[model samples]
Target chain A: MTTTHTSRAAKRPATSGAHGRHPAKSRQRPNWLGGLVSWLWLAVVLIPIYWIVITSLKTQSNYYLTNPFVPPGDPTLDNYRLVIEMDFPLYFLNSLIVAIGTVIPSVLFSFMAAYAIVRSSGANRFLRGVNSLFLMGLAIPLQATVIPVYLLIIKMQLYDSLTALILPSIAFAIPLSVLVLSNFIRDVPKELFESMRLDGASEWKTLWGLAFPLTRPAVVTVSIYNALQVWNGFLLPLILTQSPDKRTLPLALAAFQGGPYGVNVPAVLASVVLTILPILILYTVGRRQLLSGLTAGFGK
Target chain B: MSAITARRTSSAAASRGGGVLPWLALPALVAFAVFALIPLIGVLLLSFTSWDTLGEIQLTGLESWRQVLTDPGLPHALWVTFLIMLLSWGFQTPASILIGVFLAGHQRYRELLAVLYFIPLLLSSAAIAITFKALLDPNFGIGAGLGLDFLTQDWLGEPGLAFGVVIFVVSWQYIPFHSLLYQGGVRQIPRSLYEAAELDGAGRVRMFFSITLPQLKYTIITSSTLMLVGSLTFFDLIFVLTEGGPGDATRALALDMYKRGFQANLMGAACVIGVILVLVGLALALLLRRIGGRDPYASQLEGA
Candidate 1:
């Protein structure tokens, strides 16, 4: 690919004169209209987020009476304070634990399985069959599994614990993670692995030191995808955890919003703002990596 | 110390006997078997039996299946689910493609717009549902503030409007994903193609239709299928916002399954719904694979 890019660059000079003859005037109208429409569409897409943030910052009185488009007349931190006081911190921590717990083991196990499947000799067909089986997981919607999952959790005596959340979350994540990671690991240049083998590296060593490093971006992408799914997940937590202390952020937020304590709209929004902060920060840091990571399997 | 050393040596020797690779998958395979596959089988079996939460399982044969098929609620729920899927795909896919094309050349603002559009994807669906619930509140929401109170119909309460609201929320949450897919597809086209089209005095629209859309066919099929499957199985946001209320107007199959299986403890009926959901997903997946002739993950794998 790099060679192709360089070769293409070398070929550019012969076409330079023809390209130079193209008038800027001919392109200006489309570019201007395109720019304007893109910006307008972006604004429309962002309005809900803007509304959420603005509403979160508003005072209770301002929430009901102020113009929703405008900034609050007297913005207050009371809502955030209230949410914190309501022990949102605990829910946040539970969510963090579940997300990280699910991600780490899910990635590790899937990486190993994917690596073995991709690199093992004479098993490509068998591995593809395995891959298709895992793909079936993608079709099995969570609603279908929730009852059985609940039953299994009960039978295992793990209900209302973080284990109940972590175990199923990891199970749900593994099939897709393995599918993604195996595809990625399969794409590692065979020459690199052969070179590593010539140097007397073991299979595990080659996978860990060579293939894994090259696949870090894909790993991060998969991890983030898995984390987001775990974090935003509601049904599993809703059915599995009966205790408030065991609740995750989404389930906790639902409880806060729906409870008989009367609707504290500002605080609910504040909790949302807080819940969304980690993902936003992660996105800011890794937006490009995320895009490339997400598009890894896009084209054939 | 000597015993431990000998044990470690024996284990190492055993690992060298071609068992290491299979052992590596043991944890994952076992976990999936116990938690995912076994339970799924259990649910399938349970679907054929009559069992309340408190009672013993009894073979009911096809009774539950028949009831689920004949249930009035099932058809309505199926209809709502299909409508949401159709509406979301109908509106969001074209809009995303247009936005993706429009943003392709303008690299400067592309990152910014992508970030903004992706905000909903990052936020919890429950949070977004609650936020929209507030925003669409008839009495004091932003809708009323904008004097579009006429637009402030009970978004989650009015049967006529509830499905539309759910579709909008689902589309809003996913538009970024499709846009990102299309953007990547557009980026994959060699810039030289566009330049050549320009040299031929082709308009931007013509260039896009002639060059870009064909190149983006794979992405379009993939994103549309994803959106369809996603909308079909969707539960959280609608469950949070509407609870399938306003007379089951917004009840998707997944939500209906939840209400039946867990809320009502009608295990057999819920499992029947589950089977239907799986069938829908498989059909969509097969359709996508047929049209796109490529897996969505294939490109990501190569890039990796």
Candidate 2:
């Protein structure tokens, strides 16, 4: 334990020092090649997004007649209206339910598990085993497990239900969530936990009152990442759920693309925009936290 | 370091008292075990059995394995999957590293650029595939809309172009993420190293190669592992984009599994593919970890 702690301590200052000196270091040299690539990559990244947004607003006929990059001169909500009429709102609601349903339970469970693993500090054989299991879980492609999941869902008589989607999703999310949350929880000072324990605070209380607050950013990060994954998820929903009304936004988007509305390019693009709009709004409002949190979450 | 002692002293108490800490992990354990672990085992078991989409499972020893191994489609699918993984990894790594180094700078415009760069990350794969499909329709897409005959070729209609489009679009979707990872990795490198190199009068490109690239070894492993493993799960994007069209040009293993299990009603064969996918993913992850000389997460915690 001391060895690990000391090693980590040895590395922390170097990174913090680097942070302080980063701006100056970058300013000392103008990275012309990287700058050129950055701007060029920016164009590569933005062109399609720009095209999608503008084309979605265009009338279907105007879409064919006009430049793909230009915003529609007579922008209309007619495409959006078409999407709305196609039960996009319902699909959006289904996605919301699945995201929320999956996020809450999975995050909560992962938090508890992470708190346990961190607090145990590898002393408990059970937790050590569990931690190793999750570590192994990270390497295995969980997507490959979907076929059996589909079978299990069928066996449980939960086929085609939102619950089927939610169940597998929660399971798939656990490995990464636990890994990330444990990393964050391990960062919380053990002295804090010891002090809280001395104050006669129960482990559960310390978990919620102490560790939870200290790691709120991680909680938020994991929540957003998991939400993004579940919201954008397609395979489970495609396999598990068959009813049109039960479709999530991604499924709905695909249906709209492959079906007759597929040829109605504007309407299809409208569905695409509508599906992404909520997350876009979230990104706009919480760009800083979202970006930093995600970077830290995955980067570490 | 004090936390180590604190945790150490408490561990004895924890073991003696047998506290609620272990139980705290039970819910997640159960969830993962039931849904993930069982399915993993089930995929293997089901591979030995036969089941159509609507039929009862019938035990058939070695039949599925025999079928999958003998089928030429399996090799083709595996080839496609490998091609996508290798090409995307090659394309994304350098680009991500460059953009990451660029964005690691403290510039207001870089932040703005990052904001736009991540937009692709937010969009669902299905939505992205749809947008691109329409944007590359050849008849009414960007080519025809802009009257650029060069851009107007059969982008998705032909085998080679469709394959290239898959790789290109995949890079478009994922480069931002890998870039973010690289950016974080870049920012973490000690400034003194760069300063020392600068004092030696090293050029930017020279320093990038000599210092930056070596320092980002772990990050490269991490990003590459993600790219390789994540490619196995490209079902949503490919399924939405081309549906393995243009004469099976893009029918990677994931899509192959989906087609076999869901479309063609070959559940056993699909499970065989699933097992193969799991093996390939684990093999690649382990191989990368071995190359990196440590498990990244463990090394991160231990500060290796």
**DockQ of all models, two decimals each:** 0.33, 0.52
Name the regions of candidate 1 deviating beyond 4 angstroms. Answer: A1-28, A31-37, A121-126, A295-300, B1-19, B294-304
TM-score of each: 0.89, 0.95
TM-score for chain B considered on its own, for each of the candidates: 0.88, 0.97
C-alpha RMSD for every candidate:
6.5, 3.6
Go through the candidates in order and give the clash count of each: 9, 0
In candidate 2, which residue pairs clash?
Answer: none
lDDT of 2 by residue, B1-304 (tens): 7666856755744864747888999999999999999999999999999999787899999999999999999999999999999999999999999999888765556777888988888888998898888888899899998899999989998999999999999999999988888877786688789788887888777888999999999888888888889898898899988899788999999999999999999999999999999999999988988998978666545523
Residue B65 of model 1 has an lDDT of: 95
Error of 2 at A96 (Å): 0.5
Candidate 2 lDDT over residue span A39-99, tens digit each: 9988988888888888889998898788788888899999999999999989989999999
**Global CA lDDT computed for model 1:** 0.75
* Cα DockQ of the candidate 2 complex: 0.52
